[model samples]
Target: MAGAALAGLRIVVSAGPTYEDIDPVRFIGNRSSGKMGFAIAAAAARRGADVVLVAGPVALPTPDGVHRVDVRSAAQMHDAVFAQLPADIYIAAAAVADFTPRQVAPGKIKKRDGEDGLTLELVRTRDILAEVAVDPRRPRLLVGFAAETGDVETYARGKLAKKKLDLIAANRVGVEGSGFESDDNALAVYWNGGERALGPAPKTELAERLLDLVAERLRA
Candidate 1:
């Protein structure tokens, strides 16, 4: 039912890590490889949805049949995601930076002989998922991803309720050989009172299973 159930739906997916520039040569970013999000985009496209993938700074090739939009900073990613509006589904899978430098140094800051340490004033970036949840052009099905190091379910459920998301996939990062930069992942997917666990398997396989659930919810 991959091609049948989701045919003609417009799906927008955000992927990779948003780089918060500290200087010309340095940035604050997570360990996301964009594999999970890219896999979801490809799976959605294969299921007959018109997919638009808004990706951050990743070296992966664009998936076939997906309209790829490349962006660097969290601000640019925010703008790009909003521009692809009025879609049927929005999957916020990107590892977006929660905070950014208050100001980017025009040039690289050099170490002084007597300086022991340096500090940066950080500011909160716009919460893309929260914004989309309240947008007038919000998709029918809005999904969010949580990469947590502790109490994954607690945090994921809190985010689900706070952001008013339809579904959230929580994964444990910092575990060797899975999540983040890994090609495989295990997701604890939660939606309201319902939840399901999907795979300690390949991202591609997990993606297809996730979309199947999405399609099921869309129909109900």
Candidate 2:
């Protein structure tokens, strides 16, 4: 990190939660704060990597020396990521919505009297990570993130294989002081046959550690 460890590398990172709109004023989203991906971009740029961040709707400022493309929905993020790709590394840290409303109402959905509940038909959003894994322009090191409430490693490993990713960082989401909207996080990183535990520390430190692992993987 003190030198240009990632020099000459092109990296793409995605962060934050995709908002799947239900109506003009309502949407389905998650708790991701975009801190982790931004930190990664910052650290990578500091290490002399050309970084492009495809970010979701988050209030955080763009990291210095990093190019950013802001997006609101999952589909836009997918397009933005691919546009910047053929990168040396791709880190998918965004918590994209699994489902979106099949049809979006053009106007604000109004509550009707005596209608206590409303139902919405939803459809699966494109699996951006899975698509990236199979893309001809896929990066050399494809990394993903899994935020889970239970069986973290088990789920993370499953996703790694399912998405054919080179590495994955998994963390528990329901815990206090870590994961989603918190400044700190802990990650268990897994590859084909190896894994490492990192943090319970600040996200900035975690990002540096994560990049260190990425550099080591690139060397191998």
Candidate 3:
């Protein structure tokens, strides 16, 4: 692969898991360790692209030469990405929660002695990728992740069209040691005219391969 294939390009990437607060002491979140997105950011920077990484809560060190913005919630992630928009590429790798508590409790709720059960109302979160895809200043290439367990290709293709993304990276979630919070990953990439399998390698190798494919698409 040419090291300068993505030279001078600007890339924006979102990584990690968004937290939705239920109370001051409790929140809803996923198990994304942010390894994949961080790997992508590092790969893009290595390819000489200016990278802006909008990250959620994670312990990964900042990749050399990549600007990172840390955020906690899905809404914050969405805002951060758009604030630094107009990039050449946008990759939505964060495992964003689909719903959040309708209202965050001011304080922890006390358990009722006689109550048999409790119910909580939830609301759909803003579809960050969909929002960004429809923006007038959206990036030239938009990539989304469809973390599905079954019917991988069908769901990925659907998301590609529904989100109006240039490409979608599909992976199986909920399998034993396969998806969320895993260090090694495999991807089935789908686009308008083609699809390809990426890997079961280390995150860094997969990132490099994915970047190469992105560069090829951009050049074409």
Candidate 4:
């Protein structure tokens, strides 16, 4: 670790799927397993960075030499990340709920007998990645993640610029054997005027390669 590329740096990573509660027991969430982000945190820690991982609800064990903060909702994740403030890099990898029920039921929403259907009104959650950009103490390298089914590069690049991100890792979800919950993954990482492909391997390996790129860019 003494000779590692990320030595002496501070990196923050967000992971998992945030649960938006519709009731005490029911919540809206995604299928994110947090493998990619957790892998990145572990890799960065191995490379000697002081890593702070703001993780949502996932069953994974905490990686060695990393500080972990657990959270359950998008709003909670948002608070945790910002409270940590001023990292050398920020990896926004959580698959946070885009929207949540407009108002949570005070109790369990009981099914009406013979009712054909039920309706749920939802409202957009705050864009956590975008919110980080306006911080006066924003990280030096702000990276975002894009999971799309089509036009991967186009959408990723758009978000990279739109969110004022320094880099973004994009992948297509709903494909067999990868994305979301899979341990195996790949990424097309885009930064200003450049890009790189990392895997089709274990999420851990991809994270190392991605961070290698990050180290290179940091040096540049």
Where does candidate 3 clash, by residue pair? none
Top model number, TM-score: 1
lDDT on C-alpha atoms for all candidate structures = 0.95, 0.94, 0.91, 0.90
How close to the true structure is residue 130 of candidate 2, measured as C-alpha lDDT?
97
Tens digits of per-residue lDDT, candidate 2, 103-126, equal 999999999999989999999999
lDDT of 4 by residue, 1-220 (tens): 2228688888999999999999987998889999999999999998889999999999999999999999999889989998888888899989988898899999998889899888899999888889888778888889899999999999999999999998899998999888988889879999999998877889988888888888887777
Order by lDDT, highest first: 1, 2, 3, 4
Q: Please, what are the lDDT tens digits per residue for candidate 3 over residues 1-220? A: 5558788889999999999999999899988999999999999998899999999999999999999999999888888998998888999999998999999999897789899887889899899999999999989889999898799999899999998999899999887656777888899999998999998777889899999888887777
Better of 3 and 4 by lDDT: 3
Off-target runs (Cα >4 Å) in candidate 4 are: 1-3
Segments of candidate 3 deviating more than 4 angstroms: none
RMSD of each: 0.8, 1.1, 1.1, 1.5
* Model 1 lDDT, full chain set: 0.95
What is the number of backbone collisions in each predicted candidate, taken in the order shown?
Answer: 0, 0, 0, 0
Better of 2 and 3 by lDDT: 2
Pairs that clash in candidate 4: none
